[model samples]
Target chain A: MVGGGQLARMTHEAGIPLGIRFKLLSDTPQDSAAQVVNDVVVGDYRDLDTLREFARGCDVITFDHEHVPTEHLRALEADGIPVRPGPDALVHAHDKGVMRARLDAIGVPCPRHRIVSDPADAVAFAAEAGGFPVILKTVRGGYDGKGVWVVRSEDEAAEPFRAGVPVLAEEKVDFVRELAANVVRSPSGQAVSYPVVESQQVNGVCDTVIAPAPNLPEELAGQAQELALRIAEELGVVGHLAVELFETADGRILVNELAMRPHNSGHWTQDGAMTSQFANHVRAVLDLPLGDPRPRVKWTVMANVLGGDYPDMYQGYLHCMARDPQLKIHMYGKDVKPGRKVGHVNTYGDDLDDVRERARHAADYLRGTITE
Target chain B: MVGGGQLARMTHEAGIPLGIRFKLLSDTPQDSAAQVVNDVVVGDYRDLDTLREFARGCDVITFDHEHVPTEHLRALEADGIPVRPGPDALVHAHDKGVMRARLDAIGVPCPRHRIVSDPADAVAFAAEAGGFPVILKTVRGGYDGKGVWVVRSEDEAAEPFRAGVPVLAEEKVDFVRELAANVVRSPSGQAVSYPVVESQQVNGVCDTVIAPAPNLPEELAGQAQELALRIAEELGVVGHLAVELFETADGRILVNELAMRPHNSGHWTQDGAMTSQFANHVRAVLDLPLGDPRPRVKWTVMANVLGGDYPDMYQGYLHCMARDPQLKIHMYGKDVKPGRKVGHVNTYGDDLDDVRERARHAADYLRGTITE
Candidate 1:
């Protein structure tokens, strides 16, 4: 797996029981996955030589992030290396403009969007879309709300163009809430979709994810799964594919963004689902039959533990374990830093309210936000 | 952890979510836990220098097995190292004679037993206990059916005497079945016990374990748990302690043996319990609050996957995964050899029969005992 972040850290863990030998191409020895994964190659993913060296003895190459240069991946594929969610599908995740154009061509429900040449082009597209508040995003290298701007007028759009990267102008989605449809696909075209989850964001970083998107009509949930699975097939994605969606107030769902690998939105599956997304991703990449994606409990709430006032969360574990003995905590093995996702807590039970409160309390307590 | 075997491998996996750094003192880099744990010292654990170096920065010293020398542990404790299940408690697990004597002193129910000096002494004890058949076990270094003998006569009893280790002779248990009572304890005296489980032994090696021991009278089950918890506290065990027991036809429970670390009997907790035995072991050794020990489902069956006809079990993963998507497979990084434990599968659900069959089938399929 390329990019040894928390996603790779978790995928490496899921691979252990399957007896899969993980060869991680990490940026440094201190990267989250590198700290645990035995066979790790610390190198830059952009360098073709480094990618080739890392793929030498690997059966199949996969990624934790979509930031790997497309040309480097193509070179590996040219050399007969199997890259799951190959360069073609991964490019869409790397560039928002490409993803928007592909989704529009495929008739997938997406917000009105266009590739903007400059700040003026963004303003014109916003005017055509009947909006003053537009979302401007760099076509490449944006994540976790970075390289994204909510522009209410032409004057506010100038900042994004100054970075000099191509920008995509999108009509601000009038959504009631955000949802994620996570699915995994194998090279044989077999696919499995997890339940749609309600994702609550704090300052553009995901703070909590409630599985099954409470109160979502059954038919709509089925439609969301169908859409996500169709997208995986259409894009020829061979691993996990997360479709971030906007649940509009008009009772319709529109595509917001796409992640070709395991995304933060699917983290709840680690403890909630019969088969975690990380495990299925490993299976899909290996072209093995996937495991079940059914929820293990009636409800599961996952809350991200961002590094906050407490630099040592271990000090809070005693209280958390005593308060909620069933809560599953997953730490990323990273140094604590304010506003960074260092871990997550998952609580599952029949009572959604109770589960949600337990999860919130644990995450908050670990962050030192709640003294009690 | 003192030993780098499957128990340590699993404990390391459990500690990952808690951000616990495991420093393994493995005999080789290829040891099961050594392959995954980052801070590893590949050295002989029997050497005082090696043990001292390994214990330098560790917060508490613990073991995956009970074979660590009592003298070495005492020295470590003398130097102020926190040796959980310290020498005094660990010696009982290391020696069957010691365990029997201690249990007898505490009035714990055990079989008619005595430390015999020779074959004649064993024969005399057996004759006095009302039978020709007698069970003889080495006082130290026995595991997985080894160092144990069931002798029916004086001629058969002579073989164990040649080993030169002190032998404990006991009246062969005339039990309907074997059972295990598992419990974990913290240094603070807090303890939690899992339900008693029926353990099936094939050729004296554990083949399967059914949690809650199907149809066990509630009162008997409660007694078994209470016995195990009392044993943990009485021994001052600061980590997981598994009490192997014999459930006689007369509805009496007798102590068989003890393990001061994670045992095969509790493997089902990986997927069946609210908190796994390995996780609780880490917490207990760290003196942190313990987690719940309740079963997550009505029934759980765990079947050990012994290395059989197949050298590569990964070949059967696709079939087993597709056949039972909910089956949780845990494979130790070990080369396949007949009669060796390579992994185990867990199945849990409302129906005991279904869970049992699923677990059995998965284990058999992985071992290549069954083609389909």
Candidate 2:
């Protein structure tokens, strides 16, 4: 695995039961996954020499993020290393413009969008689509609300261009709720799609996710899964692929974004589904038959625990654990910093409201946002 | 932790989510837990200097096994190091004579037993209890099927005495099956008891465990839980405690043995219970509130994956995972060796028979005991 963030931390954990010896190329020894994984190389993933050395003796090289340079991945593949979710598919996640163009070409439903060279082009594109209040995003190096902006005027649209990166403008989605369809694929063409989930975002960061997208019509849910599976098959993705979507009030779903690695929206699967996204990713990359994606319980809610002023979340565990004994808390081994995702909590049960409340409360308490 | 084995490996995993910093005193870098835990001291656990240095920064010292010398534990306790399941309680697990005597004093039922100075003494005790076919066990350092014998005569009984350890003899009860009651206790007096489970032993090693003990009368199950809880309270145990019991054909339960750490019989709890035994043990030792011990499903079966001729168990994961997508497999990072406990698999569902077969099949496949 390349990159030693929380996703890798969790993937390392999921691989333990499968007897997978993970060899991580981390930027530092303090990276979340590096703290646990036994075999780790602290080096730059972008360096060809570092990547070559790290891939040695590794069965298949998968990723924890899509930030590795496309040329470097192709280089590894040229050296006979199996880079899962090969560069061809990974490029889509690396650049929003490419993803939108590819999805548009495939007739995948997406908001009216166009790559813009300058502020005037963005304005013209927005005018052709709808009007003001358009979404402007940098085509690369964006995550967790960064490199994204809501532009209501030409002046606001010019902000993203200052970074000297390719920008794209799309008509702002008028959605009732955000949904995600997550799936895993293998090189052998095996694929499994998880239930569509409703994701609640706070300040553009994923806050909580409700599996099966509560109250969603069965046909629409099926359509979402089908779309995700088709995308995985069409793109030849050989690992987890999360399709973030927007469900408009008009009863239509539009593709929002894509992540080639485990995404926050599917965190609920760690406790809710028969097989977790992390575990399935390991299986898929190894070309092992994928496990079931069915939900184990009727409802499941996962809430992210952002780092808070309380440096020691362990102290809050006494209250949270006693209050909700069924809550499954997962923490990334990281220092607390305001607004950083440090952990998450999963709650599942027969009742959606009860499960949601338990998950939310535990996350809040751990983040020190709630005292009671 | 005082030892670096599979229990420690699992306990270390459970502690990760709680933000617990585990400092392990492992005998070698190759020990199961040592392979994962970052803060490890490779030293002899019996050496006072080594133990003292290991416990310096640790908030509380706990164990993966009860074999730590009683004097070493006392020395640490005297130095103001908090040793959970203190020597007073751990001594019971360390010596069979002490445990049997203490249980007898507290009115806990047990088979006819006596501490024998030599082979003649063992013979006289067996004659007084019933006849031939008595169980002889060493007072300390015994695990699995080691240090135990089925003595039919004086000659056979002399085997254990050669080790120069204290020997105890007991009438071998003709039991219909074996059961285990596992519980966790916090220093604050909070405790939770898991469902009584039926454990099947092959060559005195735990082969499989069925949670809730299929076909067990509710009354007997309740009695077993109550007895386990009482034992924890009476012993002042501040961590996981497993009460091994024999359910005789006459419809009575007799205490067989006690383990102060997580036992093989409770392995099913990793996936079946609301909170796993390893997690609860960590919480109990940390003096945190205990989590719920309720089963997540109606039934769960855990089957140990004993090492077989196959060296690479990972090759078999593809079949086992695809065949039973819901099976939860846990592997200890250990080399394959005949009859060694390499891992275990957990299967839980509403149907006991279905769950049992799935667990057994996965375990057997991983062990290479069964193919196709």
Per-residue CA lDDT of candidate 1, range B172-237, in tens? 889999999999999999999998999999999999999989889999899999999988888999
Tens digits of per-residue lDDT for model 1, A1-372: 999899998898787777667789999999888888778899999888999999998899999888899998899999999999999999999989889888988989999888888878877998899977899999998899999999987788899988888988999999999999999999999999999999999999999999989999888888899999999999898999999999999899999999999989999998889899999999999998998999988999999999998778988998998888888999998999999999999999999999999999999999999999
iRMSD, all candidates: 1.3, 1.7
- Model 2 chain A: lowest-lDDT 10 consecutive positions: A13-22
Model 1 CAPRI quality: medium
Quick one: best DockQ, which candidate? Answer: 1
Superposed on all Cα atoms, model 2 deviates from the true structure by an RMSD in Å of 1.4
Off by over 4 Å in 2: none
TM-score of each: 0.99, 0.98
User: What is the TM-score of candidate 1?
Assistant: 0.99
* Shift of residue B203 alpha carbon in model 2, Å: 0.9
Q: What is the lDDT, from 0 to 100, of the residue A265 in candidate 1? A: 91
- State the weakest 10-residue window (summed lDDT) of model 1 chain B: B13-22
lDDT of each: 0.91, 0.91
Clashing pairs in 2: none
